[model samples]
Target: MMRQFTNQQDLVHAGISYYTTCCLNLKSLYDNRIELKTMFISKEWEDNMWSKNEAGRRFYNLVVSNEFWDGVLYAINSFEPVVDVLRRMGCGRSSMGNIYGELANVKREIAFRFENKEEHYLPVWYHIDCIKDEHMKTPLHLAGYYLNPLFYYQNGNEIEKTEIFRDALLECAHKMYPDQSVQERIVHQLKLYRTASQSFGRARATLMNFDPVSWWELHGSTAKELSTMALRILRLTCGSLAYEQSWIEMVHKKKPSLVQCNKFEESTFVMVNRRIQEKAQMKDRSCTCIPSQ
Candidate 1:
């Protein structure tokens, strides 16, 4: 029946998002919503044997319900920000420097999308906050955000006055370079960076480079120690697995028994491994069978 409106083969299939395909499924269903409603109400459906049955009538009721469609719309809007963050992390590259900023942006995006309605965005924010508070917001992440030239240069001296940034830098400095002398030197270099002095003040440094680690490499020679710190912090992984695991744990909290938790973990593991194997097999086949010139 659905194929009559649009070929099922042409609709979105399972390879769009990482691990879970819920977002892709939601997107596909939402895209075909009008077609679905029209099909349910068409004379063809009325003449069908199943349409007169109790189960079919109930299914039809759901398809035409305003409340059901409203809920789907709300889910799409709420889930999109989280999915975007996941997509950014899954880009097969280092995203340590951007995760903190990205999470902040997620909250802001959700709020803005719902026109600042607390009731609408609060539940989503609460779950995100739980993940962030427990796994993210470490001194390392904060240091990365502070050192990344992408964010640092935008806020300018304003970040210098921010206690959280100052504290995070100090914490990372002490942790990474325990020696008092080295810590003092890092602090001194931080001042130079803040004031845009030395190598940091070079005309070349003023150019807008989006890669934070690369920016430090190119323009941070004068403060070699701070540059090294930036490279280490910025090169770290944002841990896409951590986000996925945290979400799973959050769901487990709402359910009962270790059996359910184990089942969920097993299913997720199988799904991800299957996809990985499929990609690997495809790569091998392509390598073995060269295209004709």
Candidate 2:
């Protein structure tokens, strides 16, 4: 029946059971709405015994319903941006530098999709805000947001002036540094960073197009203490999938050890370093291949 209405014999399948796949499936169904409605009313459907059954009738009703289509459209519009965030979190590249900014922007993107109508967008915003408060209200998130070169330089001095960011930075600094003298040095170096001193004040530094971790490597040396903190924060991955993958790979190659765990720890560190080196090499190749305008 579907084949009579459309060139393809079946609905599009995303092939996986993830939430993102569900969204994709819904989008596909919506894209095939015309084909589906035609299939429901065609003689082939009426003559088919299965289509006469109560279950088949219910499915046919759903396919032709205006309310159902409206809901599907709304769900796609709302959840698409969220799927984008999930993809970034799952990708091999470090999302830590941008995840914080992405989360903040996702809310705006959803609202804009709905034309900023409060009646259409406020409920979605409430749920997104709840998720942010419950799971993402961490010092690490704030520190990453503040350290990202794109965000940091774009917001000017306002990032440092923000109270929540200020508190999060202080918390992260003290927690990571431990020593009071080191904390003081970090604070002092932060001022130099804010004022755009030395290498940080360079014309290229002001461009705000560079990768946060790479920018730190190039210009952050002048602010040694703050640079150390920025590099550590910006290099983090947003999800635990990579860690779990590393553990699975480790177990496949080596026997479990309860007594000699230091050896396992060393192996994990080596694997992590190898992954970082591989990503860096890929980034360098990608950069070299881009033609200069």
Any runs in candidate 1 off by more than 4 Å, and if so which? 9-12, 16-20, 155-162, 201-208, 243-293
TM-score of each: 0.76, 0.76
| Model 2, span 211-257: residue lDDT tens | 78888888887788898899998898785243236444665466654
* Model 1 C-alpha lDDT per residue in residues 215-286, reported as the tens digit of each score: 788888889888888898889876355544554455456554654656877866876676446544444432
Report residue 274 deviation for candidate 1 (angstroms).
Answer: 9.3
In model 1, the worst 10-residue window by lDDT is: 284-293
Alpha-carbon error at 248 in model 2, in Å?
14
* Residue 288's lDDT in candidate 1: 26
lDDT of 1: 0.73
Candidate 2 stretches with Cα past 4 Å from truth are 15-17, 156-161, 195-198, 203-208, 240-293
How large is the C-alpha RMSD of every model relative to the true structure?
7.3, 6.8
| Model 2 TM-score, all chains together | 0.76
